[model samples]
Target: MVTILNEQAEVDVTPLPRGGDGLWLSHADMTRATGFELKSEGLCRGEICVPVPKGRHDFARDDAIDIAGFWRYLGHPVAHDASRSVWALGTGAGTRRQALASLEAPDFTLPDLDGRPHALSDYRGRKVFLVSWASW
Candidate 1:
C-alpha cells in the first residue's frame, strides 16, 4: 500500500503493482485517489479533460496508470521519500503562476513561536511582513 498526499488530504491505495519507480495505480484506484478517470477523450475530472500526449506509452499499462509521471506531464511537482511509498503532489505550474499574479497569498494557518495559531488572511487589509526560516 502507498499513501498519496493530494491537496489537503491523504489517500491510501492498495493492490498496487510493483517494479517501477513511478507510482502506478489501477484505473479504479486512480479515480478513488484523485477523482480523475481515464476516458476516450483523456483523463477527465468532471467535464474537464486533459488529452494525453501522443506517442506516450509510459502513462498507462495493462491495468495501471503512472500517476507520478502523469502529474509531471501536467507540469506539477511530485515529491516523495527515498522509498517512493509516500508521495506528495502539488498544483500545476500554471495554477501557481496565476496565484502569484493575483497577488493574494493562499490562506493557511501556522503556529508562531509561542504556539499561537495565525492565519495570513487574519490580517487581510493590514500590511504584514512574514519571515520563515529553518535550520537543517
Candidate 2:
C-alpha cells in the first residue's frame, strides 16, 4: 500500500503491484493516486501536461512504472516506513525552501480544542509553534 500526500490531501492506494525494488502501477492508478496521468505528451492532468524532462521515467519490464522514480524525478522526496508498506511523498525541497524564503505560513483554518476556529494569521505578530501529531 502507498499513501499519496500533498500539503492539503492524503489518499491511500493499495493493491499496487511491486516492481523489482519499488512500487509500480499503471497510468490509471497513477492518476487515481497522484492526480498525474501519463499522456501522449507527458504526465498530464486536465489540460496541463507537466513536461517531464528527458529520461525521467523508468518503466518496469511489465510496463509498471516505478512510483518512487517518478516522484523523485519530479523533485519530490519519498519516504517509506521500515515495513515498506506505508509510503509518504512530500513536496520538493525547493518548494519548501521557497516557502521558508517567503516567511509566510500557508493559510489554513482549523478548530482549537474548544472548537474555536483559528487561522495562522490570527496571531500576526506572535510566534506559533503549530505542532501536530499523527498515529498511523
Question: What is the Cα-based lDDT of residue 85 in candidate 2?
Answer: 70
Question: What C-alpha lDDT values do all the predictions have?
Answer: 0.82, 0.70
If scored against the real structure, what TM-score would every candidate get? 0.67, 0.61
Off by over 4 Å in 1: 53-55, 100-136
lDDT of 2 by residue, 60-104 (tens): 323456767777866888888787776777789887888888977
Candidate 1: what lDDT?
Answer: 0.82
The weakest ten consecutive residues by lDDT in model 2 span: 55-64
lDDT tens string, model 1, 1-136?
8899988679998746666678888989888878889888888998879786555667766678888888887788899988777889888879888888998877788777898988899998888887787996
Local distance difference test, candidate 2: 0.70
Tell me the deviation in Å of residue 55 in model 1.
5.0
- lDDT for 76 in candidate 2 is 85
